[model samples]
Target: MSATATADLISRAQSGDHDAFRALTAPHVRELQVHCYRMLGSLQDAEDALQDSLLTAWRGLDRFEGRASLRTWLYKITTNRCLNARRSAARRRAHEWDIPGVHPPDPTRLGEVVWLEPLPDALVAGGVDALPGPEAHYERVESISLAFVTALQLLPRRQLAVLILRDVLGFPAKETADMLDSSVESVTSALKRARASLDRQRLSNPDREPPPAPRSRSEQELLATFVRAYEAADLEAVVALLTDDVFISMPPMPYEYEGLDTVAEFCARIFRAGRRFELVPTRANGQPAFGTYLRTPDGTSNGVGLFVLTLAGDRISAMTRFEKGVLPWFALPRSLPARGGLPGSRP
Candidate 1:
């Protein structure tokens, strides 16, 4: 919109015109939500923070002096809100295993960031454009991956804010400093420390092979093969598709299994009771995912969990399982009737 039109809209909004306020902020809501998701690492929390930020903006609209673009100003509000949420002690806690009659193998280690959540592909496609700016070190896709986000949650809150603003969102150092009410030198120092810490966490490794292009024939074939093997409970077939360094983690539950052998053993224990699953294909965080349903004796399948796969080239490198509570976020149903007595297949 032209400057004059925006000024008029701002004037109307500042005069308590709710419609004018919505019009002025509608263009930015999705991207701002994504920014919150990156900072807080939970879709629900992001939505909460976004709502809180918008409310704060609406209440404080008169203070918007038009010095920065409205989008940047919205981001400023959203980011600070997320930082406050992160600093709170009530962040989602790790969940204990509640699956009846299923005992998993001992995990290699306990995951520290258990509140990590997946971002739906559709939501991301709606909000994110191309890379934010020239200073961005990570591509839009890599930046949102579970590995990257998990690593982000480990940083000091200020360092996290600075790194995301300077590197991921590509905000200039001075602008980031202004947003945090810190000096440029402070922002620069925080970003430098954040980058080194993140590299040590292996958020991105230069030598790693990228996954197959989204929805490419190769990706489709790999996903299909995985689903078939997984549903059939063919441990050997499933294990064949894994990279040697593959790991499996279930959040909410802190258990994490690393390496092909350990992950294979965990799968073996899960299937030891002849348990079978019905897999529904989906995508999360730009990677292939599935809604896993446990087959029941009553001729129906019950939603059990969501599994998101991370690929390195054609091999599966990581699998992250979320509790069934996340099913609705992916638009997956909680249950499905038997496949007319035929073998279950992808819907």
Candidate 2:
């Protein structure tokens, strides 16, 4: 919008014009929500923060002095809201094992970020602006990957905010400092530290090939093979598709399994219980995902959980499982009555 047009909307909004306020903020809302998700690492938390930020913005519209673009101003509000939410007393704590009838093998290590949740591809499909600032260090897709977001949660709150504002979203250091009420030097230093920490978190074997292009024939073929093997409870077939160092983590439960043998043992426990699942495909964080359903004796299928795959070349590298409660966020049904066909075909 033209500067004059935006100025008019701001004036009307300051005069309590609700529609004008909505018009002024609507274009930037989707990106702001994504920013919140990046900071808080949960879709639900991001939504809450975004709502709070908007309310705060509406009330403080009179304070917007036209020093920054309205988009940047809203980002300032959203980012701060997320930082506060991160420090809330009601933050999600790790969950204990609650699965019935199956005992998982001992985990390789306990996971630290149990509150992590997936962001549906549909939500971010056209929401992220294609053009990032020249200073962006990561691609938009890489920035939102589960690995990336998980690593983000480990950074200090201020460092997280600075890294995202200056690196992920590509804001200039000066603008990022302005948003955080810090000096440019501080923002730059925080960003530097955050980047180093993030690189350490993402470290993997140097010889591994990069993952296949998103939804390409190679990716779809791998996903299809996985669906068939997992649904059939064929451990051998599933294991064959995994990289030697594949990682598996179930959040909220805190269990993390790494290496082929450990993850195989975990999978074996589930299938060994005579439990069978039907896979319903979905996409999360620009990666292949599924809503798994357990088949009951009565022939109905109940939602069990969601699995998001991290692929490297033709092999599955990591799998992160979230509780069944997250199904609704992906527009998936909690249960399915007996049927000859799946609710959604494999990706």
* Model 2 residue 210 lDDT score: 86
lDDT of 2: 0.90
- CA deviation > 4 Å runs, candidate 2: 203-205, 341-347
lDDT of 2 by residue, 1-347 (tens): 88899999999999999999999998888888889999999898899999999999999999999889888899999999899998873767899887799987888999899889999998777557646778887888888899989999999999999999888888999999999999999998998899889778755568888899998999999999999999889999999999999999888889999999999998999889998888999999988999999988777899999999999999999999999999999999999888655532332
TM-score of structure candidate 1: 0.96
Model 1 agreement with the true structure over 1-347: per-residue lDDT tens digits: 88898899999999999999999998888888888888988888889999999999999999999888887888888889889988884877788987677787888999998888989988888767735867877788887888888888899999999988888988888789889989999998999899999879876446667899999999999998998999989999999999888988888889999998999998888888778899999989878899999998776999999999999888899999998999999899999888764565554
In the order shown, the candidates' Cα RMSDs to the true structure are 1.5, 2.3
Total backbone clashes of candidate 1, pairs 3 or more residues apart or in separate chains: 1
Query: What's the TM-score of every candidate structure?
Result: 0.96, 0.96
Q: How accurate locally is residue 346 in candidate 1, as Cα lDDT from 0 to 100?
A: 51
| Residue 255 lDDT (model 2) | 91
Task: Estimate every model's Cα lDDT from 0 to 1.
Answer: 0.88, 0.90
